[model samples]
Target: MSIATLSATPPPPSSRAARRTGRLFALTGAFVGVVYGYDTGSISGALVFLSRDFHLTEVEKGLVNSILVCGSIVGALIGGKLADALGRKAAMLIVAGSYAVFVALSALAPNVVVLDLVRFLLGVAIGISIVAAPLYVAESTPARIRGASVAAYQVATVAGIVITYFVNWGLSGGGHWRWMLGLSALPAALVLIPLLRLPDTPRWYVLKGRTERAVEVMAMTDPDVDPRAEVAAVSAALAEESGGSARSLLRKPYARAAFFVVGLGFFCQITGINAVTYYSPQIFEEMGFTGDGQNFLLPSFVQLASLAATVLAILVIDRLGRRVVLLCGIGTMVMMLAVLTAVFGTGELSGATTWIGFGAILLFTAAFNFGFGSLIWVYASEAFPAQLRSTGASVMLTADLVANLLIAQFFPSLMAWAGAARTFAGLAALALAALVFASATAPETKGRQLEEIQGYWRNGGRWPVAPEPREVSPGPLSPTGPAGCAERGA
Candidate 1:
């Protein structure tokens, strides 16, 4: 295949079809984000009320939060195979439905055991969403704006987190934890509505040997382009990587990539992002932000800041590129966490100190948004060979949830036992290490197609410079191919 053959024969630029296709793909992230945010954010306020109503001890309260993460670990492990078997769109819709049903059922739980079980089920949906949705977006989108389109997922997540705060604050006044928990179902339900209109991933269709359907889906997802070459490319990549066994992750070349991705996922959470995001108000109260109840406002700002950072990342991801942005973001987070540790180490620092501490937190949120939050899932989905993409996503995200579970379960107790200064400072050290790891190991993925990335990983940092557009041949007809695939334009 030659470059000319893979060149997108887009409909007239004057046509509106491409824009519509782009919008649809972008919204997939938005829907996914809302659901993710609601599930996570709703828990805090609900847990507060439940602890009061059910007289939960500190350990029990932690259990309520940690149980979901446990379920997520299980879901992420299996999610890849499900995506491979069911097709990305179908898998996502099924997860959404499962999330809705379980969340609603949680509202009716009569005891802690039942509540924990229901919450665990909800976690499965969350885990599945983390893997399948991103894979779908990566496979469905063209490369040029791939960062921005898929970024909608992160943006949506931040939005979901912020909106749930508003929902929790509104319902908290009435002491309706059930309403807070139940409110999550709305986003899940809404996601399902639009999902009915979405097309399956072209890669998945091709893997199933439905090239004609893959072409049609490409047209619907990017109508301005003739998808024949892209379809052919996807078909070839699927053929080369057809055995979707989870154990294959430990085999040659893939083994190293899997290690890094799983490390990245686990480290992303161990930074204590979820700890604060999940329990911000409690932390603020400990800092002495008293009963003005302005604590609710903290997470909203964090979410908004995160959203802004994600937008910035989208613009520069293909420009300044992934490794640089991650360095900057994680480095900033380390510095902010240091300041946080210093402030909290002083023991009962309140008022201005508390506000400064919060300022430091906002910076951390910005850093995460720009760096790990945006890149983690994107890289996880794209960094692997086609055969291992889904399974790799599953393994990495499962590791992520395990870290999430640990932090969510023991963080409050750790704060009490270790003191705020030591706890945050420890997290700061982890962030520093993450920054170093990213600089030493992460590759520049800007403008490279997914196929180009495969060679980048396979060569272990000695990968060749990408071919100039004019000199490039179309090469193979896989998703990772030099031409005819999403990476060609990326």
Candidate 2:
């Protein structure tokens, strides 16, 4: 059906079947987050045992940890093209399989070199999953709950981390780092099983010119949605695509969106969240919580706080809006970091001061999880049009990987050279900058449909002017006259 014809017909009412289908896809997609969390969290605890077993130097230890991020950088660089060419579901399946293989290999590594190489390969899978899972969730779900659905991935990620902490604690006594690392393979296998049954998203089908199948999938996911109307909207959007290359993102309007996505990513990582996540036990040790028992117990508390905060973000992100949560979260993080800097800088690493530092770490984790940690992927997944969503997310995630690599790789040296206080002060400064950038430019995408969000960017970051009843222009890509807005809705 033509865009004009489809737009004139009102959307069908939503049905329980459709909502169930959407929820299923969302939950399945979140398994990718579990794989990610397990891999990341498992490493932090494993590092201690791995270091003892392998006799790893400080620099070598960092490499073992940072190499995965390095591999993820390459993975993200190519993830956009892979997702676009292979389709999101196919790409994610590949990611899950790769994770299964490499994580198992990481457990068997005879030396640090083999471990680093295997971890990097696993990272590539992580990079692809990061881009594909959220893209699929954003496209399959309805706009009203899009933010919460996408944030579900983050919730699952934190959940995975929390689970790993307990696993690490259980295994820490025996120094069974191999078992800790190998356990990640279980989640990767779990993620793969569900993906085997899932379908490629409707938007993807439309992009491939399979309008009938697109409609069928949409019907299954949202019984109330008018499939034909949605297909027309998809068709119109695809027709407007200049190309899907990275170069295309450098063009007008898209360039701005790319910058915004990248900035969001940079801010998310620069705040030192990964440093804390990857090395929380080490940090606790530095703060006078030495010995095996204290190290295992204290860091778990930090992760628990993160897990709770992520749940809070998922509940309230759509209601309070992205900008508000992000700004507030980052601002709170800055205060916590400043307090940490003061505590660490004064060389008061004993008694009440150490306890205060522990509290500050928990608070920092809470704030970061509530804001940027949850919103970064949600925002990236929704910011661009369907044609560019994969690439846009990859670009944004690549920026995150870069920040993670640098921070993870250099955190120890930074702490050693500059001291923990100075290191924290530096992060606090970066958080302040993120707060400013988000305040001035963050878009409110709480309730808008994905296409409406595109229209907002197309109209230069403001809402598109109300659709006027002008004559429909020639060609499929031309404006759909007054009914154009009807497709996207109020």
Give me the runs in candidate 1 sitting further than 4 Å from their true place.
1-22, 141-146, 244-255, 447-490
Clashes of each: 13, 2
RMSD of 2: 6.4
Instruction: Supply the global lDDT for candidate 1.
Output: 0.78
lDDT per residue (tens digit) for residues 1-490 in model 2 = 4334333333343587678778888888787788788888888889988999999877777888799998888887777668778898898889888988999999999999899989989988887777777888888887667767877887888888888888888888888999989987877888777788777888788777666677777777766557777777878877776466678789987787888899999889978998888888888888877786678777788889998888888788879999888888999999999999998987759999999999999999999999998788778878887668756876887788888888888887788778888999999999999988888778888898988888877778788777555676687676564556566455
Q: How close is candidate 1 to the true structure, as a TM-score?
A: 0.85
Query: Compared with the true structure, what per-residue lDDT tens digits does model 1 show for residues 94-185?
Result: 88899789989998888888999999988888877777877777777766667666667777778888788777777756778898889778
Candidate 2, run of 10 with poorest lDDT:
2-11
